[model samples]
Target: MPPARPPSRTPPDGPPSAPLRALVSWALYDWANSGFAALVQTFVFAAYFARAVAGNETLGTAWWGNMMGVAGLVIGLGGPVLGAVADHTGRRKPWLAVFTTLCIAATALLWFVRPDPAFVLPALVLAGIGTIGSEYAMIFYNSMLPDLAERTRIGRWSGWGWGLGYAGGLVLLVLALYGLVRAPGWFGIPHHDALNVRAVMPLTALWYLVFCLPLFLFTPDTPSARVPLSRAVAGAAARLRGSLRDLRNHRHIALFLLARMFYNDGLTTMFAFGGIYAAATFGMDSSEVIVFGIGLNVTAGLGAAAFAWLDDRLGSRRTILLSLMGLVVPGTAILLVKSKTLFWIFGLAIGIFVGPVQASSRSWLAHAAPAEVRTEMFGLMALSGKLTSFLGPFLVGWLTLATNSQRLGMSAVIGLLAVGLAGMLFVPEATAHGREQDRA
Candidate 1:
């Protein structure tokens, strides 16, 4: 047998260490970048992009929907290829830097998008680039887990990072809501002026830039493999080709990825459209939408905090299963509720589960993957998550367009969730269990 793997490079002592700091820095990337997900991608800009900028409500929604679908496709297809490159090169941070910088630059460009149909196409493209870049960057960051947390504490630590990310998103939401969203009149401008929305984009770009400092400064980079960059890329390409061919060989992993794809599609659809469903159904204004965003962020943070302990106590799979059950309730309620009050009530249920599910999923991966191949597996996870992203939105958008009823669009979400819930049962009960068996 091959010699036993070297004792993990992780420090063998108490919590405080260079590795812990590095992990925190990695987590902070999520903290910093979440603002884009919360304010720009989901709520405020989604409305602005769909209704205001596109100028044709139906076409705007369809256009944005298509952009997301295309992005999902690209990331789904390309993730594993790049992921293997990181593994072969032993250079996760550099990849993270390249993608994160692209995200930051694209986010900066969002400032130039005025509320006009002429700007819609470029805006959608840049937004897609930013979305794909940020998410792919996250793959490398997550692969750092083995170098940081002890196995037993992975769930709690990962949960804390997710909670911290929600908190970051919350802070940005409050700033957007109170500083820009509430002020309507700023520097001699009306509150409802379209330019007010434009102003928030620059701030988001700045937020991403500022908060990413910790990772670059505090975290130690992974040791680079001796391969030159060109050779690394070539090696990565060949390995990627082989991995795809060998996919069927990793049956349990492939099965888990399929389940993740199904459930994540549902989760993503709810997040992407929940606010729109509220607005279309209850006639919510921008201010109400802002409030809803803030509320969800708050609940999501709390949920992450609560589930951190639960994840450790019960295991990642159990936490995820419970969280999915929670999501199903709110997800179903959206179709049934006619009033804004009930929508928020149900939304609270969704917010409660969102954090735990996300945190546990990451933790589960940490437990499941071998250190040498963690980056590749995490990249594959990203691919699976993005695969059906297009389908869910396309299905919802098409259904909504055909029926001209937002309720019907949301009703479609329930089917995705139910499928996801069923799929969850098939994933292993504890990713750690699989790891232990491998060690045996």
Candidate 2:
């Protein structure tokens, strides 16, 4: 076996001189997957899967939620191990390619999931597997960010990615809405037929595959470590054991992870449930839901673009704190308002904060971590976020199921945000870019 390199104490030099293509490629993952989130998670698939594809609509949502929760657990538990392999092997692109193809193929196979009750379990299982693959791939992608943007400018670049992703999602959702949802008559299909919704599944697969091409073509792969795959796997297992032991040694980072876990739970819950609430409370039909999804994406894109500079200039910590507060207030307000007008108002509020939270959290972790261990750091970040990601959906599902009230379930989100904010407050300023060394 080759000698293990000493843990890198200093960050590699200030970010790369020019990593524009790398930045674009990193953002493209977001772009590629946003279609899945928008069309499958938000609008078309969930509706179709539950109402048309499952034996029971209400029960299917619960099962779908369970599948998502299981996917998150798999990702959270497995991410660090895979990321360590990437760190040791010193190649991220090949792994990315493998997972990306997995996601694309799984999404494409959804084309077969017609209005058959027997297909529910199998379809959700495929989707869960895709979710796991896409999420695991993201760990490697996030680890590359520090190489692509300067220390102070990372947040801006991250925001750029968030904007690009939303843009891609918006484009495809528009196509699905206009071409399939609105014009079924031209295709000699009924307006609310299963075929109309079925069309979106394959289109989402195509969208994800097409947009992912830029990243594969442009982004340079991390250097290979010259280790065989088997040895790399063994080394990664050893290092992960050591890293878990070392976790207690890094108290501040541990605390930060815990905090992020809870807050991210709130943020994720909002994403998972926001549309359901609108549809349930205000009675938004499919077209209105599509329009709402479009508006959210547009506003979210603008919010990311607008806040990118603010994140860099002010620092990631403040940006996250501000975003958490912004999210909390408006999110709670959604429950109070009875009218659809007010729901849109609250949704716009959500759009404003959601982009920054998503973008700045990434920058914040990059700033906090030592350079050589960036992949490990990002992997842990993904793990923490994913582990907690299940809490929101589980909580929402349970509460909604028990109370038959969306409003009651949403209250839990407020508590989650508060805990995340408080935990962040205790995190050292250095981690938040309060010190000059951190800025470097």
Candidate 3:
């Protein structure tokens, strides 16, 4: 077992301010990474890969699902180990930098993927690598949250970061739409062979590279443990084992993690398929998908920012339940809706709940994790979110293939969300510094 630690100096309920510059810089990492999520994973490139590279939406969607499933599996298995390693080494920024750079490089290399069937394999490979990079980097980035914010304010800061991230994605989607895809010739880029759409890859890479600098340059990292690399690696397994055993004592957190596993998988599926579903079902084209994406981001950003205070006031557990309920309603409506107009309305409504669910989940973990094992716990958090994440995509892809209906494939998400909501009902709210709030 790791040695017992002294009590934290920060009060459990106070609102001491975090350093504004560091806080913003840390949050801006979210902004920086949003370029990849918006452009590559969620909106532009995913649509392009489906319709252009794979030569049809159906095959492309299945392939994309497989790729995401593989990536999720890798992330789920590796995140906790990496977090354990980082916890042992005691510096997270270096790991964050390495993974962020990998993502940027992989994203930039995506510029080589032409809109050809021959390019499909390369596209999936690169996108999967980039996904792995982005998700791994997030483990370290998330673990930094408790160190930055006071106990009572973690939710607000988390929401602010997610809101900023959505705004960043929204802006990038607009730029890709109008600046490149819509008018590539104006910038001396040719429109032939879908090169205009392909250009967004490098553009996203550049955006990530430029915007990610602030976090590396300004955000404070946890102090180094001064443990040698060999020692850290050697001890990681033991530490992870210890952390798992310790988790048994925190039943509420464990239950919360179990609940999160389902809902987060649903969210992951929603993100992976949202654009594809729109294009495939509604017969919307790439430009329409981007427009749809922008609208979703607008609502998601608003919801996250607006719900920031409510997370702290009403408590993270209640905030999550509310968001989950909000998601379920619109999410089901989306599956039933045949009208493109109605799809847009329900999709946008779903987005309003997406960010709050994600942001509050992060804050909840940050607020409840013991200081000694915090990073490892965040890793476990990633594990919870990703471990069965493959199931969501796999089921969607399998069902889509079986039923030949995107709608039916997507109905799996609602089931997953419902399971998570049920599980959450049993979890008590976790409060400052690993304490559970009293049920009475």
Q: lDDT of all predictions, in order shown? A: 0.77, 0.76, 0.89
- The residue-by-residue lDDT of candidate 2 on 236-324, one tens digit each, is 77877776677677666677788899898787666655655666667776667878889989988888888889888887778888888
Q: Give the winner by TM-score.
A: 3
lDDT of 1 by residue, 1-440 (tens): 22222223333331233466777887788789898888777878877787778886566666777787888888888888788777877767888888888888888788788888889988998899998888888888888765567777888888888888889998887787777766643344354447677777888889999999898888877687666777766776776666656666665566667888978878777777765666567888767887888899889999998899999899888898899899888778767878778888988778989999889988887777666666778888988898778998888788778887777866767787788778777666555432622211
Q: Model 2, which residues run further than 4 Å from truth?
A: 1-11, 55-57, 185-193, 430-440
Model 3 Cα displacement at 288 (Å)? 0.6
Q: In angstroms, give how far residue 24 of model 3 lies from its true place.
A: 0.8
Model 2 residue-pair collision total: 0
* Superior by lDDT: candidate 2 or candidate 3: 3
Name the lDDT value of residue 306 in candidate 2: 85
- Estimate TM-scores for all models: 0.92, 0.91, 0.96
By TM-score: ranked, best first: 3, 1, 2
- Which pairs of residues have clashing backbones in candidate 3? none
154-270 per-residue lDDT for model 3 (tens digits) = 899999999999999999998889888886434667789888888889999999999999998988877787888887776877778777887778887889999999999999988
Q: How would you order the candidates by lDDT, starting with the best?
A: 3, 1, 2
Better of 1 and 3 by TM-score: 3
Residue 160, model 3: Cα distance from true site in angstroms:
0.3
